[model samples]
Structure formats: structure tokens, C-alpha cells
Target: MAAALELFGARDPDDISIDDVAAAAGASRALVYHYFSGKRELYVAALRSAAAGLERRPPPAGGAGSLDALAGALARYFDFAEEHAAGFTALLRGGGAGRCGEVGKIVEGVRGELFASLTRRLPVREPGALLRVTLGSWIAIVESAALDWLEHRDVERRALERLLVDQMVATLTAAARHDPEASHVLHNLKNDR
Candidate 1:
């Protein structure tokens, strides 16, 4: 799986073959075939592996302010992003295997899980449309920033993490003005700190 991820990361999945994965893993082609019926199966398994690794890390400990928790989560996020650079870029940019049937589901599942995890940490009883849209936008921003950071490497990781967390606060703060629920959530965040 690691071999497949490395191969997929460096090049498009369509360009990689069973032989490539076998050679990278130092195993015979037959062995690779024995485990995976074909290239697509192996590719999906490798992507599932990557997704699992990213989700394995626990969110920041309880009682940490929402902002602190967000910072911690973003740090772990960037760690995975850095480790999987090309694969991460390919996944978020909707290129390569990510567009395939199973692959697309996996990507959407990851995004949904991430959205749920972050919002569950908030004090809101239920997230209304305004807050939902606000958080969704924040997630998009993080993905875009990660892609840009991978391509340019101009911003330091820590600075970028801080910037993202600030963006979240700024976004929430703005939403609070028009949304009472959002206002309550923002008030809790301030008090939590």
C-alpha cells in the first residue's frame, strides 16, 4: 500500500501499473495480482489507506478552546499534507483517481467526516444554514491553501496554520453578526479561550 501511495503520489494513477507497484514494493507481479485483482483495486486500497492515516489522529483534547482545537487539528492536517504532498494535491484538486467512482466517494466521505468532527466541537445545539455555510467555506479555504502551499512552499507551515485558524475566527465572527446561533457559538468560543 505504501508503495502504491508513493507511486500514485509522484505520478498519475492511470500512468502506474501493477508492475510499477510490484517493483516499488520489491515483490513479484504475481504477488501483487494475488492480493489485488487489478490496478484499480490496488489504487483504491492505497487511497483508503491514506485516508485512514489522516483520520487516525485524534482531535485536540477536550477543554481546549475551539480556536486551539482548530489550530491543533490544522497542524496534524498539514503534517499529513506534507507527508503526502503530491497525493494530497491530486486528491483535493479532483485529479487522477479521485474522480473515479469509489475514489470520489472516499474523498467526499473524508470531507464529510472532517466537517462533522470540527462542528461537533462547537457549542452550538444545532448548526443552522449560516453556520454550516461558514464552516464549509472554511474547509474549502483550508484545502485551497494546502494546495497552494504544496505548489509554492512560500508560506511557513506554522504561519499558514495560524492564518487558517484566524480565518475561521474571522469567518465565524462575521457570520455571528447576522446569525444568532452563530453569535452564540462565537460567544462560547471567546469564553472558552
Candidate 2:
């Protein structure tokens, strides 16, 4: 499973084969077949394995108390992407519209977790239609930025995390302008931070 996870993370699913996974794991192709139904099953399992421990590794709030929750989330996420660069990239880029149903669901499940986490931390009273859209948009923006950061490696991770957190704060601040409840939420966030 570890070998399969690394290979799937590091290469396109099409580029990898049962033979490759077996080779990586120092097992025979027949043995691999005994464990997994087939390639697709193994590939999806690899993705699931890679994502297993990531959902709970929230970043530390140390020195980021000003933007505590947002900062913590971004820092942990940045670290996860950096640590599993290949898998993270594959999950975001490969699992898309044209992908297999299971693959797409796995990808969207991770994304949905992200959206849910951020929305939960937010201090909104009644999350409206626009607010939901806005929160989802923020998730998209942060994910793209993290992918870019992983590929480029030019910007420092801390800088990237800071940029994303600030961008989100600005977005919420702007939203607060037109929404009284959002305004209250923003005020609470500011005071709490």
C-alpha cells in the first residue's frame, strides 16, 4: 500500500501499473492480484491511503494568533502539500471531470472536507447562498495557489501561507461590508484573533 501510494502520488495513474506497484513493493504480480481486484481498485485504494492521515494534521497556532484559525489551517495544508507533493498534485490535477467515478469522488471528498473545515471555523451566523459560494471560491483559490507553490518552489512556504490567509481575510472583510451578519462575524473574528 505504501509503495502504491507513493507511485500513484508521484506519477499519473495511467503511467503506473500493477507490475510497477508489485516491483516497488518487492512482490509478484500474481500476489498483487490476490490482494487487489484490479488496477483501478488498487489506484483508488492508493489515493485513499495517501489521504488517510492528512485530514487531521491541522497546523500549529504558534505565533499566528492574529489570524489563528485561518493561519493554522493554511500552514497545516501547506505542509501537507509539501510533504506529499506528488500525491497532492495528482489528486488535484488528475482527478477531474474526465476521471473515473471513484477517482472523482475521492478528489471531491477531500475538497469537500476542506470547504467544510473552513466554513466551520468562520463565525457566520446564518451562512447564506452567496456566503456559501464565497467560501467555496476561497477553497478553490487556496488549492490552486498551493498547487502553484508546489510546482514553482520559488516562493517560500511561509510567504505562500501568509498570502493565502491575508487574501481570505480581505475577502471576508469585504463580504462583511454588505452583510450585517457577516459584519458581526468579521468583528468577532477580529476581536477573537
Measured by TM-score, the strongest candidate is 1
Pairs that clash in candidate 2: none
Error of 1 at 85 (Å): 2.3
Residue range 17-122, candidate 1, lDDT tens digits = 8999999999999999999999888888887777887888777764654667778889989999999875676566544753478878878877998888877788
Q: Candidate 2 on 159-188: residue-level lDDT in tens?
A: 888888777777778887776666665676
Cα lDDT listed for each candidate: 0.82, 0.75
What residue pairs clash in candidate 1, if any at all? none
- Can you tell me which runs of candidate 1 are displaced by over 4 Å? 62-65
Model 2: residue 90 alpha-carbon error in angstroms? 1.5
Report each candidate's C-alpha RMSD, comma-separated, in the order given: 1.7, 2.7
At residue 28, what lDDT does model 2 achieve? 100
